[model samples]
Target: MSDPIYEQVRGNPKFAQLVKRRGRLALLLSAIVLVSYYAFMMVVAFAPQILAVPLTEGGSLTVGAPIGAAIIIISWLLTGVYSHFANGPFEQLNNGIVRETLK
Candidate 1:
């Protein structure tokens, strides 16, 4: 017998449809992530507020600005999140499904 998830994926119309939709959506999300990284550069370049802060002992470089280091941290988080899919289980699942479909 096949793996239950695979079996369900093969047999259930809703499951199949969900996979089809989500599979394509994953690709789109991945692409969006790739584009977002580049866009962040533009955003950083345009906004001088990202790293503008009082040069004090206790002040960070991103304080007292509209663009906080928190957003940069979030950008890194988003990059890491996207990279997880780029080089993680979702990629494996996508490859496996494609290989299975091709067979």
Candidate 2:
């Protein structure tokens, strides 16, 4: 790879140590996030109205919605969280790893 950051940290003990310490946790969390993502997607796909709803004060919200939208909304919230843990953490870890190895 033509990555400068990686080339910089070609050989370093601390970098390996850091990866050893945090790699497992990062991987585990990332897997969990991915699983949750899949689960939520499945739910949404099988039951979409389970996520799109409107609030009603007097009567039940039966305005053409499945009424389970609330559940779907909460599930959708997990999507961003999953993305953060998976993509965000991975990127940060790569950058940090390169920087630490270099220095």
Candidate 3:
């Protein structure tokens, strides 16, 4: 594409909004995952015994098992959150921009 056409798309208000929204969403989700994973790692590093504690009086399940599972679940949920935005408003804005730019 020519510089002018690219510049034209960049100048669109909707394009700017889309960029900001997507950036914010991605940063938010990334921060969540990073904070969670780092917190878990810190717990592992500083309190290994805490994670070793059994979930029940006689049960074999360790506390770490569920917490680890939750981290994975949270990652999946974050992905879904992004996908939800991408598949809906983001996609609509993106398609509209493409159509407008092409025309």
lDDT of 2: 0.59
Question: Pick by TM-score: which candidate is best?
Answer: 3
User: Best to worst by TM-score, what's the order?
Assistant: 3, 1, 2
Candidate 1 residue runs with Cα over 4 Å from true position: 1-62
TM-score of 2: 0.35
The positional error of residue 21 in candidate 2, measured at the CA in angstroms, is: 2.1
Per-residue alpha-carbon lDDT of candidate 1 for residues 51-87, written as tens digits (9 for 90 to 100): 4645677766454343444455666776676677657
Q: Candidate 3: TM-score?
A: 0.91
List pairs with backbone clashes in candidate 1: none
lDDT of model 3, residue 54 = 98
List model 2 lDDT by residue over 21-87, tens digit each: 4666657656766675676678678966755444465656653344245445555665566566546
> In model 2, which regions exceed 4 Å deviation?
1-17, 56-103
Every model's TM-score: 0.39, 0.35, 0.91
lDDT (0 to 1) per candidate:
0.60, 0.59, 0.96
Candidate 3 Cα lDDT to native: 0.96
